[model samples]
Target: MYENNLLLERGAARDLPETILLSDFLLDCQVRNFSPRTVQSYKSNLKYFLSRHPIRISPEDLKVFLVHIRDEKGFAQSTVENYFAALSSFNDFLEWEGVIERNVVPQFRKRYLRQYKDQRNEERQLINLEQMRDLIDSAEWICHKAMFVFFAKTGIRRQELIDLDVQDLHVSKRYAVLKPHAKRSNRIVFFDDECAQVLETWLKWRYNRKIRISALFIGVQGSRISRDAVYEAVTEHGLQLGFHNPEGLLNEKFTPHCFRHWFTTWLRRAGCPRAIIQELRGDTRKEAIDIYDHITQDELKEDYLKYIPKLGIKL
Candidate 1:
């Protein structure tokens, strides 16, 4: 029995190649039922790290890798953070498998990445109500108009908007059921009559086209719109209306995300309650009080209709 126990312990502690470890870690991610996108992200990040440093991961080597990505490769702060997150998850897996005594990625992040304040929020473009109207009106295509109104009124992320299906919308109800997203806490978003009208017109036009796809929005070829296409459509209209400047700073340029900023800002200007705005924006409840503050869908819709600005879209 003593010899058998020794053999079990030795097998448990057997050394594995870094590549084998990475494959195992990824398999663990799959076993946990992580989304395909998430699993792909982990695989990509780990593969890049392994390609650079083919040996065992150490805190010092990790630091060097991070510096190389941040400084030499000029990756954005968010991208760098994503890389760190992948590494941290992998380290946790290693520690769980007894490959390491403890995970050090959290400590490394606190000592390095967590010190800087993210200024992207501060530098986001803020357009006024009239300018928003101009942007909607200037759209050459009905699809573009509907998309802009949806973004400005709903304040959903680009990916969320793109993921919307035809069945998710209730045109008469002036509401939409957004697809599941990691960051979005609430899946419901409401729009005003102006937005509804534009959407109805787009739907009619889309029906005329007779595209059989389930996507709420589509391209010229009757396929679900790509992310780049959405970006281009928004930017094109923004430039035409002088709301976007490609040569300007982050604050001076209007992007699809700017609509979300506009929605939040205007809702506050209209004196919407913080909790109501939070619910409408699908923001995660972070505090203990937030957990108990349950605002009903009816209340949310009532406040939303009262606060959502009128763009006077003449469709």
Candidate 2:
């Protein structure tokens, strides 16, 4: 397990003290190809437990720790469930290593009992064609315009956009490579003609300027733009266009994940096959695509044209 620390040279949290056992478990997760985000969440949950409940003993101590979280911390049922998951994994590792004889963390399920009715009927909050046009028209900077165009058309997650490399954009294929360190490893996402045109224009303008950064989106000093910058850009744009409010709305409600949601939802409304949608969105399960992917391009075009102005380009 101590050897596991070497593999985490790039990813481990520096502020936290090193643990041979914890490092080993994390290394195992990495070997399993679990998404970095999932690994981080699991690590965070385990770290929080270790920080608060620092007692070293047999497996029975774990059961006592769970009870304390439930009875004393007043943590939500879901949060407690996550804590149980973290500890359960740790206990299993200890046993496998022969450090402990038994595993005692009880498995528990999480449920959210809503007091009020679900608001799903509320119109799916997506940027319609008109709102999208307004957003593009109002963008004052080339960077902001390019960023909005990239997301609105490609429908990638925020982190994916942050990690995007210039080489990832396959202009000939009309697709962009979305290879994030977390979640979906590498997915090919296609874009529309208008977005391609917008990006080409931006690239031309940028090329003439003397920027030598390899990153698609460069910040001051020619550094790659961070995820936070993209978040801020989208949030400000949404607010300026009255698409969403700056406070409590815009990004807080619609986040970078929402763009992917919008894409999936739009594809469903447009009548794309569930299998195709799943393939496009990099979803592992086909059940959701089956449930939602029932529309066709013709039907979707008819529905969308009612809201989205004439694209002039045929689908």
Candidate 3:
């Protein structure tokens, strides 16, 4: 009798509409400090699933939905995986809240989605030194030039770059402190004299404009620059130099992330030791030995300055 009662209670808990549960989940995401873009993505993916199925979902229902999206809707494999990820997260929430007896999405993914997953590796675009120099030189604005130089010098992720504030940068010291992130092992990144020169020029121009925002990079209205703006800026310069092709594969088009590849590749070529390069890249240490291998700031800066490539752009 107790077992039957427990089953009834679980069913009743799941009777709540999908929209209500989604709202609660999104609220929890906000409380956990998820970025706005990520929360919106979760919301959209869950809404699409709810449109086809009720909140009281079963493993069979999930399998059918995945098949429909992949086979009938003809979504890309990655996009299908994204939809499943959103559903899997929601299932975890349901299980945690006691609305469901167990989360089945994980098992379903392993059984159904794993077999079809793509295993091929994709290559990224890597421009040579002369091309990189020409790309930076062709930028019409000091701000764009500084941004390009900074990305090449620091090898930080795009979001990390966007999160920068004027206070985070120490121009005289030729280094900047990146914000804390789960994936980053180091918070400090150093720049060379060329990068510092371009940054100083941009800062001087920005200060004269009387912009009051603390962001290191700003849009026309003195607001923080968005990710889209950065992509467009990089693409514009890339296209002008015949380096970015809209109809090309991943390796054929130049993007902001390519700067990181260029940085890592050239530093390796310059004979910067593997440990030092990893430290400068801020990659999380995975090995047990990696945790014990400490690279001091001064040492890192010295090697970074020694190895970082120069673009030969006249200030």
Candidate 4:
């Protein structure tokens, strides 16, 4: 049960002059089964635009408001387009409820001819077989070794791995469902015989330590491994292997997401279909799934073997 605490605040209607009651619109979206993350984004964007442009004005004034944001506020064309989308949905809701007679936001589309593109582009980093082997061989902690092997094999998102709970992994079923902090998607990743065996070995080692923890991976405080911890673990191990200098390898710009990108790229080169690769990475976008539609699992397995020959355990 999501409370409407954030959506509706006291005197919000009176204080917010131009903006509609966005909470109502968000509730509608929720009822329609839109993903929670999508609803949150819509709410955030709409509130940001409206709060910044809060002035008593007619529907026709939206054009001037948009131009002001673009020219004076220095918002990029793409960001402005996203603002229009958020407001358009809210305005449509208002129009339906008799708050306004005309769809002013929809008219902006024809007036501005705005084009929207995703701005959160990710950079690609390919960690080849040799680099991965070196990192694994240098791992001082058995748990860290398991973490490296799990990431190298599965390509789970950094957040997904961070969010992994011991109970979430059903070894008998050969699958794990990771619920990430993001609301966009949940990932269900499979584990083959090799990964399972390594995981089992790590679990045995953990048991011998006689510590109680629900997280598959834990930090110094016995809490779940965070993004920072996982990253440090990877970088430290890589540096220990002499594959990279401490300063050169753990640069701020390079991060766990790079591992995910490398994993996906490797999968594509191995001949796995784009859809399968996207599915493996827990991506929900159809466009993302279409890019590598020509690959096969057999080719991917062969590629993995060529790179990590020590992984003699077969699927």
For candidate 4, write residues 216-246 as lDDT tens digits.
Answer: 9888677788778988887666555554444
Off by over 4 Å in 3: 1-13, 31-33, 58-78, 111-117
Kindly list the per-residue Cα lDDT of model 3 for residues 1-315, writing each as its tens digit: 998887776677677777778998999888877767678888999999999997768888997898899889999777888888888888888886778778888898998888666553568889999999998888888888889999998999888888899999999999999987657888999998899999999999988987678899876556888888999999889998998996787788898899999999999999999989999999876798988877788888889889888778876
**What is the TM-score ranking, best to worst?**
3, 1, 2, 4
Writing each residue's lDDT as its tens digit, candidate 2 over 88-200 gives 77767665555556665543222222211242333435776666667766777776677776776666777777777778887655677777545552376666667677777
Residue 185, candidate 1: Cα error in Å is: 2.7
TM-score to native of every candidate shown: 0.86, 0.65, 0.87, 0.55
Question: What is the C-alpha local distance difference test score of each model?
Answer: 0.86, 0.62, 0.87, 0.65
Candidate structures ordered by lDDT, highest first: 3, 1, 4, 2
Candidates 1 and 2 compared by lDDT, better number: 1
- Pitting candidate 2 against candidate 4, the one with the higher TM-score is 2
Which residue runs does candidate 2 get wrong by more than 4 Å?
Answer: 1-18, 37-45, 55-92, 98-106, 109-124, 180-186, 219-221, 246-252, 285-315
